[model samples]
Target: MKLALRKIRLVVHLLYGMWVVATRFARVTAQQRLELNRAWSLRFLQLAGMRLVVHNDGARIDEGALVVSNHISWIDIYVINAWRPTRFVSKAEVRKWPVVGWLAEQLGTVFLQREKRSDAKRIMHELSEHLVAGHVICVFPEGTTTDGRELLPFHANLFQAAVSASRPVQPVCIYYEDAHGNQSTAPSYIDEMSLGESLDTLLRGTPLTAHVYVCDALAPGAERRALAADAQVAIEGALDRLRPVGARVRQAAARGQAEQDAEVPHAGDTPAANGPLAQ
Candidate 1:
C-alpha cells in the first residue's frame, strides 16, 4: 500500500513537471529556468526515495564549464541537475522519448545525431557557443549508459567543444549505494529496459543513495582524445574508491586459507595413525 501511494505520487509529480515545462518554461529567464530545474529535480529524487550526496572536491566553476560524466542511469541527468542545473548534450533519440523527450527539449538539451557528420559539426558549434556564453553544458561522453561498475571509453568528438571555447572540462562521477553502503545496481538503466520498466525498478528499490563526486577539472586546450582519456581515468578511479570490497569474496578467501592451514600439521599436533608415514 505504501509503495502504491509512492508510485502514484511519482506519477503526479511527473505530470506536474510536464505541465510546468509546457506552460511556464517559455516565460522564465535563464536563471529562473535553472533554479526551477534544480528544484524540480531535487523534489523528484525525494519522491522517488533516492537521496543525493555530493562531494565537490574541485574548484567550483558555476558556469562556462563543459561538465562530463560517465553515464549509468537515466536518473543521472536529474542527479546532476539537482546539484547544478546545466544544459545537456544527449543523443537525438532522446528528443523523441515521449514525455521525457519533450522535457529535455524544453529544458534546453542539445541533441546530437551521432552518425551524421553534418549534425555533429552543427551540435559541436552549438555546444561551443553555449560554453562561451557562460552556460554550463554536460555530456555523457561514453555515449550510452552502463552498470556503473566501470567506465566505457569516452567519445572524443564532444570534448572538442570545450577546447574550442577554452572552457574547463569538469568530470563528475556518480554511482548508487544501498542502505548497507554496498554499491547498488538498483538505479542502473542499462540493457533493453524500457522507460516504464526502469521507473518501476527504481520506485520499487526505494531508499537508494546517489553519490556524485565532482573531481578536479582537466584544463582546456588539450587534445580532445587526451582530454577524454584523462576524464575516463579520473572517473574510473572515483568508481573504484566508491565501491566497497565484496563481503562474499572476502569470506571465500578466508575459508580457503583456513582449509589450507588445516591440511598442514601444526607444531603441537601428532600425525594420524592411518597417515602414509604410519604404514
Candidate 2:
C-alpha cells in the first residue's frame, strides 16, 4: 500500500515536472537552464526515494571541461545533473523513451546511435564544439549500464573531443547503496528490465543512496586512448575504495567458491589426491 502511494505521487510529480520544464525552458538563459535542470533533477531524485552523497576531491570545473563516469543505472544521469547541470551524451534509443526522453531532451542531452560507426566522428565534433563554447559535457564512455559491481571498458572515441578542445577531463564515480550503506542492485537497469520495471523495483525497495566521487581532473594533451585509460583506472580504483563492505565480501566469497570448484576433479579425470601421477 505504501509503495502504491509512492508510485502514484511520483507519477503526478513527473507530469508536473515535465510541464514546468516545457513552459519555462525556452525563456531562460543557458545558466538559468542549468540551474533549473539541477533543481528539477533534485526534486526527481526525491520523488524516486533516492538520496545523493557527494565527495569532491578537488574543485569542480564548470566550463570547457568534459566529465566522464561509469554508467550503472538510469538514475546516474539525474544524480549527476542534480550536482551540476552538464549536458549528457546518451544512447540514441533514450531519445524515444516517453516522459524521460522528453525531459532528457529538455536537459540538453546529445543522443548518439552506437550502431553507426560514423556517429562517433560526428559526436566527437559536436562535443568539441560544446567544449569550445565553454559548456561542461558529461559522457558515460562505458556506453551502457552495468550492475554497479564492476567497471566496464570505456570507449575512447569521446575523449578525442576533449583532447582536441584542450579541455580538462574530470572523472566521476557513482555507486548505489541501500539504507544500510551496502551496495544495492535495486537501482540497476540491467538485462531485459524495462524502465517501468526498474522504477517499480526502486519504489518497492529501500531508499537508495548515491555516492558520487569526484576525482582529480586529468590535464589535456595526451592521446584519447591514454586519457580513457587513466580515467578508467581512476574510476575503477574509486569503485574499489567506495564499494560497500557487503559487496566486497560477496566478491571474495565468489572467488573462493570458484577456486574450490577448480580443485575438485572432473568425473572422468583422476583426482589430484588419488592419481598415479600425484606421487
Question: What 10-residue stretch in candidate 2 is worst by lDDT?
Answer: 270-279
Model 1 pairs in collision: none
TM-score for candidate 2: 0.87
> Which residue pairs collide, candidate 2?
none
Angstrom error at residue 124, model 2: 0.9
lDDT of 1 by residue, 68-109 (tens): 998989899989999889999888999989777888988889
What TM-score, to 2 decimals, does candidate 1 have?
A: 0.84
TM-score versus the correct structure, for each prediction: 0.84, 0.87
Candidate 2's displacement at residue 204, Å, is 1.8
Can you write out model 2's per-residue Cα lDDT over 169-265, one digit (the tens) per residue? 9999998888887888888899999988988887776688888899889999999999999999999988877886777788889999999999877
Give the residue spans of candidate 2 off by over 4 A. Answer: 245-279
State the C-alpha lDDT per candidate: 0.87, 0.87
RMSD to native for every prediction? 7.1, 3.1
